[model samples]
Target: MTLQNQSGTSTIRPTIDTMDLEEIVELRTSHMVVGGAALARDANGRVVFVSGALPDELVMVRMVTAKKDFATAEVVSVTEPSASRVEPACEAWHRGCGGCDWQHIAPAAQVAMKTDMVREALSRTARVDQPVVVTGAAIAPWGYRTTVRLAVGDDGRVGFRSRRSHDVVALRACPVADERINGLLATVVAAGTDELSLRVGVAGAELIAWGAPGALVSGLADTVRIGATAVVHEDVAGHRFRVSATSFFQSSPEAAELLVAAVTRAAAGLDLGQCTVIDAYGGVGLFAATVARGAERVVLVEASASACADARHNLRGQRAEVMEMRLEAWTPIAADLVIADPARNGLDKSAAARLVQTGASRIVLVSCDAGSLARDTRLLREHGYAHRGTEVLDVFPNTSHVETVTRFDRFAPGDRANHPDHV
Candidate 1:
């Protein structure tokens, strides 16, 4: 068969005719996928997705599932290991703990691949042609997670879920988690709970037991709550913010500060005096508190009551208003800048429409899901929003999750006049 290559030249492609199905073959992993798998192409030119393999490594892989265009495989042996390959710090990694998929990869390599992954996602999903610049990749990738949730079996064993399976992988310590969590995990055995969440920050470690409400049995954390609600204070970029056990917060405090800095940098050229800045889906007012100091009015709109309460406390001294409403339901307010940090589901149709219709001068979006971010970006472009730039942050190290902050500015009046839906 003939196909157009990257250079736009028609080239003859070869297919594997003699290759046996499910046979073990040596393959070279050329790149890392968004989901933490290494990608390779077989002699037949079929794409192979291999787990536990690093880029530029030649490994023996046994095909688990095969189709006409692609196959999924498991690494049987690494015949040639990449320079970035390293021994995983966690013993539970081999047993299928899904928390740290890139643990076997060197820290620097992991950051490089993560940045590439974000760029690829934007180009493929959002049709963005500009190059993506990712920051905060090498800033203490390990021991950075300030919060982690552990599952509990019926027998009161605390651990994490296996990769793509419900099975629990017992863990004595998680190296990526904050040192405080590791210390707490070391002490907690047979806590007789169904689930445990550990968070450590400026306030110290806090534990929230999910099952069997009872009094604190140990001095594992600074504060302990029986259920899923506990107050945790976090210090980011020299600012203090209140975070709840159930509220969403960045796993890495240093990375969170980097993300905030990215947002502030995106807004540096814009004037904010006597103007309003809306922080949509603002969990615990992290963005609102940081940006409130510069704007005359900082409006925080959130859906969770617990988070809104925390925001009220966190933004007390600033000129901020905490609105407990979903992004879609909140009335569009006049603002100079709007920053939305939605969940993995991203901005829905209603929220996207509001963003385009809000008439904000600048919009900064912080998204964790690439597909959702791309979809929203496309929607904004359709409504005459020009793509400014994007910065990717490695918030969750050794895993597939990466935090991306994208900036957009409304197009000029002439450009908007040519838009099909322009009013």
Candidate 2:
């Protein structure tokens, strides 16, 4: 959601050699890779990942990073551009706002690229030969975001950070943000803080800042809530969810509804009414409060205390229990069903093994990263769980991110543990 595919470098910087950094190389990209970059090879047959370019396009690139295994480069110019290339719709993008990565690509092409990315990840990493399809959103791509975080500069100007740097790119408007959010840009007060958060909740527009509002914000102080608001309510699929400031929620209500329908569809035939559902890595009990509501009993495990509190409130009076703990650290209780939504790195070996230990026959997994999804799929397969199917949705349009909902069924023959006593 270009999420919000950002490239970060954790590796230590190597002492630069002037010759390599100064050399400009031209290469034709073969295809898009996992991290929203185009794959190509230089004259020396070295793998080169080119940013800001598309497949089958010849671009002149300059090396920005040099590693023994591979290198990353920035596009100096596109010698031959793909037909899918389009002028980015936002002035912020042209001003070097790193909010999106696929802004230069056509919308339809963006979906196609994300689909191919999922298929390739599964095939290369999970060893699955199944067809992958990603459904595009029905609503217009622009003005869908209900949440936006801005970085404040030394000059008190607020906007998004630049691409591949910590510098800020001041903005007057953001194209992808909801129209209401864009309206707050002029009135937003960035005083006394380096970061600001804006959101559209059921109560209305909210501006989250740590301290008291100054005269800069006094202009709209009566209109917008510009203080520490405990929880914001959002209506999704006929349900209102109490979301904390730090809770993980979908970018917009529409995206949340789309994801909810996808998860419910993936869990079909489970007859959740009579089953014990475990919402692993649950944040604010989104799945538990909605799709898993009718389950006989529900247990939600989360790492964030704030989310746990919100989950308890969101799932109040229901047969739901909120456990504040990390997924890998939680002790498993035998259940009939499970829903796991781990972070981008996916479940580590220990975490995946713990999930398998739950002995839940029906499991639904939500993944935001393709590589992690493929790896976790392989790990689950090794634990006697068969990959039933996967559904992907482009909830975040105009970005390189896609939400994947996958189902797994434990099919260990003659294994009593796979079927809990409740079943």
Candidate 3:
């Protein structure tokens, strides 16, 4: 076999006989790597990666995909169990549903691994030396997910997608889902006689059914109503955000509160009191309203028309400007502070370019994917922004998902003078 580098230089790859490649090796699971598993080959010259295996556990695996230099494998069996390995709390999670990736791993290890992953990505990818602070999960790891979208199979089964595949994995119950939502799985399965897909939000297994226009589950009455919007009562610092069943609200309210606090604190040093603030990709304007108390003017930008309408209604009496436009299409107006809470993909290149061109003095970015966040951070830093600090909030507990609030400041003469290479 041979491999070609980016420059078109070709190099011959090492040869391994079928016998040597077929051998199974027992490997211990270390920290969770990018996708999963952290393993190295042994003296037999075979590549290994820990899968469902836990730390200090010996697992046998067979190489399935071997490139010229590296290889991928599938777990064959676990010969030894790790001390930290615990029975997964979710029945659906243990049955190969990709919804919860780190269910088998211990909860404490999950948080530590996630934090390390962020720090490693920033240091290796973004080349930042600043310490990344990580806050543990805000609520119980189980039964905290308020929203879930499940695909219904033709055989009258509702389930999640298989691990790294489009195939649907039948599920009975999801432990991470709110009890209200999980309880409805049976009803949903029984109700899906002709429907091909179902997306339900759970607060406790009570179905918070949402359609194109959105609807509320019947029994939840004490729910606070912000304008026309209504959601289960969950207060943060005395502020109640009316989160509809289907509206885009953070699943982990505790984590979201911390994230909001971090963003507010990061922007507190800036002079937002007299400057225009742009909240791009603003969901229900949670952060927008939270930070608007101090800003002279706040522009809430959202691509979802329904979300925009909901935000408008939510901010009915507040002093804010609502714009229903995509971040990529919206023209950047002059502003002192720019706070963006984009989707999992983070900001697109064009949007990032426009932000750099706008040269906002202070940028507060809230991201769920660290890899994308690091990439965007590097892009901004290249366009004359300097990293101030970053804080990680555990939004999705018992899973690989995490949210971060990163603060960046415009470059000054003395700031990058010594580090000219930063430019």
CA deviation > 4 Å runs, candidate 1: 1-23, 67-69, 189-194, 204-225, 416-423
| TM-scores of the models, in the order given | 0.86, 0.87, 0.80
- Quality of model 3 by C-alpha lDDT: 0.66
374 Cα displacement, candidate 3 (Å): 1.7
lDDT of 3 by residue, 1-423 (tens): 564422245755333333256656444455445555655453345555655655555576665556555566666776676666677776666567887777777776666666777777777678876645565444567777766667656564667887757777877667787665655565453232322222232322223443223322222223312122334434554466555544677775665677778888888767767888888888778887787656888888888876787688667777798889888888888888889888888887888876666667888999888788888878887777777777777668767787888888887766655331353
Ranking by lDDT: 2, 1, 3
* Candidate with better lDDT, 2 vs 3: 2
Better of 1 and 3 by lDDT: 1
Better of 1 and 3 by TM-score: 1
Model 3 ranges off by over 4 Å? 1-23, 28-30, 39-49, 53-58, 78-83, 135-137, 164-167, 190-207, 211-236, 244-246, 417-423
lDDT at residue 400 of model 2 (Cα atoms): 80
lDDT of 3 at 388: 72
State candidate 1's TM-score: 0.86
Instruction: Count the clashes in each prediction.
Output: 0, 2, 6
